[model samples]
Target: MTALNWKLVVDTRDAQTLADFWAAALEYEVEDATPLIDHLLKAGDLPEAAVAEHNGHRVFRGYAAVRHPEDPYDPFTGIGKGRRLLFQDVPEPKTVKNRLHIDIHAEPDGLETLVSRLESLGATRVNEVDKGPAGHWWVMRDPEGNEFCVA
Candidate 1:
């Protein structure tokens, strides 16, 4: 099979809000789809109902994304081709434990500082787990309760 590009997709109550949190947390850049959104609207290829003003720019109403700051992106579409996370709005709230989660690795001796920063950004500490010889890490939840680990 040919190589495939991939991105993590997450469901959120508010795409923009979640994107904002993740962007700041990861020091990533929120994808800018304003130009494409505008062009599509003008060409009648997109409906106004599907787009809305967010952070002062047009974005898809039900979706938002963040990309690694140095990643390459399609200039006109603002779509990232490298590491990315896409958030899409969903009517249902998160009600179960995450089947999959992200693990953030901090620079040596930086875990504590990273944890503090994440807490300031609305992450809540769930608990810390220490596995003999395997190391220890902190379990935390995002603003919307999605669990992730910091090590």
Candidate 2:
């Protein structure tokens, strides 16, 4: 079977804000998408209502993304070729626990520092867990209430 390429899509109230948060949290770079947007606008292919200005650049109104800094990307569209997270605006709020969540592994002896940094980036610590021989970790929630973990 051929391997399929993919990026994680996250629903958010504000794509830009969520993208910013995740980018900082993961040390990733937000995808630009400026050249493509500008070209589309000038070619009458995209409507102004579907566009927004973020960080002084043109972006899709209800979408934003972040990618690993070292990942390959298309220069024209600024789309990532690997390791990306795409955020899309949604009208409804998160009402239940996420069945799928991200687990971030911290360096040895760096869990506390990592958790504190994430907190400063707008993450809330739900609780800490320590299982005798299993492991130790912290349950955390992002600004939009999406659950993730630090271990």
Candidate 3:
């Protein structure tokens, strides 16, 4: 088997809110793991201590995921079909730049269009990189300040 099952989970101050924002930003949805986890809890299959809330939001307190629409979901896991990003709750904020940031490629001239669309949804462009061999890109951050590049 290939070692290809890769998922990155970011620790954030707000898991649910981060999940919601990323759901919109990436055109993905929050994985509704609550029902399954809840059922396990009520059935004594899971420990009550496995769950907690952050910022008054009932979250998995460990991890949540968002995936692009038009994607398939794992019937067994109920996780997303396409590209996914997972968020988890942590006690602290992001202290430094991401070591592995995502780069989005799009029409450079129409960047304003994307900027407006993302901005209207709470994303913001932090910097504009110059055109070169790799082409130009915009450094944008999620609502939680997670940085990504848009080209």
Best-performing candidate as measured by TM-score: 2
- Candidate topping lDDT: 2
- Higher TM-score: candidate 2 or 3? 2
The TM-scores, one per candidate, come to 0.95, 0.97, 0.79
Q: lDDT by residue for model 2 over 11-107, one digit each (tens)?
A: 9999999999999999999999999999999999999999989999999999999999998999999999999999999999999999989999999
TM-score of 2: 0.97
The lDDT-based order of candidates, best leading, equals: 2, 1, 3
| Candidate 2 runs further than 4 Å off | none
Model 3: per-residue Cα lDDT over 1-151, one tens digit each: 7656566788787777777877776667677666677677779987777776644434465677887677788754567756788887787879999998877656648767776777887888899888688577789998889898877
Look at candidate 2 and give me any clashing residue pairs: none
- Reference-based TM-score, model 3: 0.79
Cα shift from native, residue 149, model 1 (Å): 0.5
Question: Which regions in candidate 3 have their CA more than 4 angstroms from the true location?
Answer: 1-3, 47-59, 107-109, 132-134
Q: Which ten residues in a row have the lowest lDDT in candidate 1?
A: 128-137
